[model samples]
Target: MRLKNCLFIGCLSLMSLPALAETVNNLFQVREPVSGQTPDEKTRATQAALETLVTRLTGDAKAAQGATLAEVRKDPQQIISQYGYDAGPPESLQVDFDPASTERALRQAGLALWGSNRPVIMAWWLNDATDGANLVGDGQSSAEPLRRAAQHRGLPLRLPLADLGEQSIGNAKTLDGTDVAPLKQASERYGPDAILAVHAQENGSQWQGKWHLWLGDKMEQGSASGASAAELADAVLLSVSQRLAPRFVVKPGASSSMALEVQGMTLERYAQLVRLLEPFGGRLRSVNGDRVVFDVSGSVDQLRSQLSLARLQEVPAGEVGAAPVDAGQTPAVEAKPGSTNVSLPAGTADQTLHLRW
Candidate 1:
């Protein structure tokens, strides 16, 4: 199925720490429609934005009804860091919250924190409208509902171009089948982590949709019916989020430290590596030449799995010996004294990683 090579574009950009840090910092922002700049209007807008932020972070629609939300409502300013108005005839208010405080609030309420480094999904939508069967693509009106749903769920989605390459195999009949080769081929340019093939039909006032989700080697298919296109989009997004939430949700685990050795690392690569590890909440203990030590807050296996998702290839044990060090150049090798060594299976070694530029 050639699934192993399907790399999302966002994962490729994780090497840029400053850009990612900014994204994480602004992850909790929300905008609400406002009529006037009155005190009452601003307060209501802030509450609405807060509700949306809570739902977006937790991936749970009911998150705003919890005890933590009540705590937040008591003094919204405690968590909200900034607010501004958007210029419009019907103006809107934008609110930004303190990320640390908001995340702490979610943790205190026993909620899961879905990180901002989300996977991008490529959607192949075929609509059987009253006129005829047509493929939906970027900038098309039919794709608007799906885009809105993705924005609301904090999911990055790319619609197909339906050009000659896509049109050759993206017909409604082929999309209905289980074979993913065509979709996979068409999705190469987008570099999505997952692909969604959606077939929708409208009959009278009702909209019916059949969706197939391709996540790595796993495939899941389902059907949904809604009264309107917007409603159907919501249903599809809900199903997608339900399946993806577990993979992205950060679970609390025992804290552990590990020493990672990377060969052929330059100054820029080292900085990128450190930035990639920032989202894991790890503390950098030391950097001895090529070796970097971290006091991380999760199990070694879990960290390894996360790194694998980020495309860090593990070095085989057979090639794990010390590399040649230049004279007067400190070799990055071995953990510090008193540091614990983590053991893993032959093929699943996590102590050493090979950096591919």
Candidate 2:
């Protein structure tokens, strides 16, 4: 009997299977998919996935927070309107999503939200944000992702070239001289109204950020933090739009420049953004959000002439060419120098300078 038992053990050993086979078998062990997980699980997963996608695509921090997965699927507009946010165009939003995100949403979130008549841009920011595992990561230190996000319309606030140029550097350096005054001038030039300013601060544990909407110099809208650059943009738009409805109006008026800082690519892209404004006779100048504050003076005609003299007309489009605007067309506006600041109003807007985000 003992000999027979040994023989049996030997036979069992002879039929040995690889450990990897067991691992694969474990992987294939489908335990009924956790009951009603097919639909419900898909819903949760999609909502979680969509939160990142929308932020990356439209730079709105209040994407899913404004609408449930069900609400978003039925009608994103309902979500947009209810939340009072503008993503510009669906195609622009679509361009920022990752292909995998699009596929996952289609499979899980249903056709309502995922299926839209929009073109996708495959922005790296959207791709990274949609990756669920990375949702909690900090993006303030990242460059390419934010740049692509802003380009794809994921960012709501637009930065002038001068301000943008100041953002792209290794450290928080200040700008000086006439070279830095025009950007600040633009900000002051903005018509007395509410605006959004993005603030990124390192808080040891995580980044402290909020999309605050300003009215004159006071904060009119709410705040939302713990978001990506794209999400912050979206949140800013929602909060500002909602708040603006009560405090301001969207009129065809002039805007000076938008200022932003993202650890990098600001300086390099500043010229690019300046070029975008130059067409409207806007000029780029020193716009460091810290220290060395300055003022600027110039008119739309002056900026255009400067571009012309710089031979920007001959330079390729989408770049800040080196040309001086015709002195004759230049406006009498002057750039003043001062200190940089970040302050929001208390309640009213009379003498306040509200800082959003």
Candidate 3:
């Protein structure tokens, strides 16, 4: 009798196991992590972008979005704290330097390297322990001016190592501000073939450098400052260029000649896209009209494809109050006389190859 009772109990337990397992599976569904993603790098980029969005949405020009500058910064800050941000942690990477020497070397290095590549952003000596924007008290030079100088050389410059506050201010902490862990959450934000995160510092007179290249979270390749600063910067840039340098950044709906894909879209949007793409030659893999696959061909414009799109400044601004451009045009970022910065739409195949750091 006892044996029979024990067998009955065991059978019942076994019968219920499958149902329980199914229930658990639904509750704990696991998604493959973003195929090519990085939380830290993404967070930083997005944090920067979010700041930009705020300004574009609110600033003097007033973006189409109805948000005001203060509100623009505030709302995003709230979400950032929830998403691409976190409260202060106890670690730090603060190092001591001549400040002047470090800034000069970095600024010059940045100028010489990015001169022809991307547009200039603001530069200034870091002041507050936030966003690395400290402007040197003396105010002689900072990342901002050099960053601006780089832009003058013809890339669409954003703000530089210094005076980033003037670029697009947001609420970001410094000291422990790297926010690397958070940025790891959204790695694609940089929009580069290879996102280059480089660090240069004085290790008792000799500069030390480190770089990381990633296609999302997976670190592709990297090098430390074994070589000179120029060598280090050049090597990193070249590596990134090599990794992301495709003749064409193709997509599914891009063209027969391109390699890319599209997720879900509408017919009207597709038709509109077709109109926009009349200039390019590409292959369509499959077209439901509403959904399309394409193969875009050729290498993208090397400079534009890899780095952030920056427009040229015809007449550089000498001071803060001076409007960077003449009246009618609204001082657009992409319409510079000698430069261009276009925001083209995406391709199909849903395929993307990017750089994450």
Q: Each model's C-alpha lDDT?
A: 0.64, 0.28, 0.29
Error of 1 at 169 (Å): 2.3
Stretches of candidate 3 above 4 Å error? 1-180, 185-195, 204-206, 224-235, 246-261, 266-280, 283-289, 295-357
Return the TM-score for candidate 1, rounded to 2 decimals: 0.69
- Would you estimate the TM-scores of all the predictions? 0.69, 0.26, 0.29
Say which prediction, candidate 2 or candidate 3, comes out ahead on TM-score.
Answer: 3
> What TM-score should be assigned to candidate 3?
0.29
- Candidate 3 lDDT tens digits, 1-357: 332232223322332321100111111111111212365554444434443322221221122133323443343333332222222131111111222342243233221111112211111112332244333322434443333222112222222222343223212232123333432322233222222344444344343444444332334444444333333333334334334323213322333333333334343333332222322333333433223443444333432232222111122224312321111211111211222323223334322212111
The deviation in Å at residue 156 for candidate 2 is 4.2
Better of 1 and 3 by lDDT: 1
Give the least accurate 10-residue stretch of model 2, judged by summed lDDT: 20-29
Per-residue CA lDDT of model 2 for 1-357, tens digit only, reads 332232223323322321100111111011111223345654443344355545333234454464335545553233221111123332111212344444444334322221111111111111123222121112343433344333333222223223333333111121111122232334443321223344444444333443333332244434553444444544434444334322211112332333211111122222232222222332222222311111212333333322222223222333212221222221211111111222212111111111111
Best by lDDT: 1
Better of 2 and 3 by lDDT: 3
**Worst window of 10 by summed lDDT in candidate 1:** 1-10
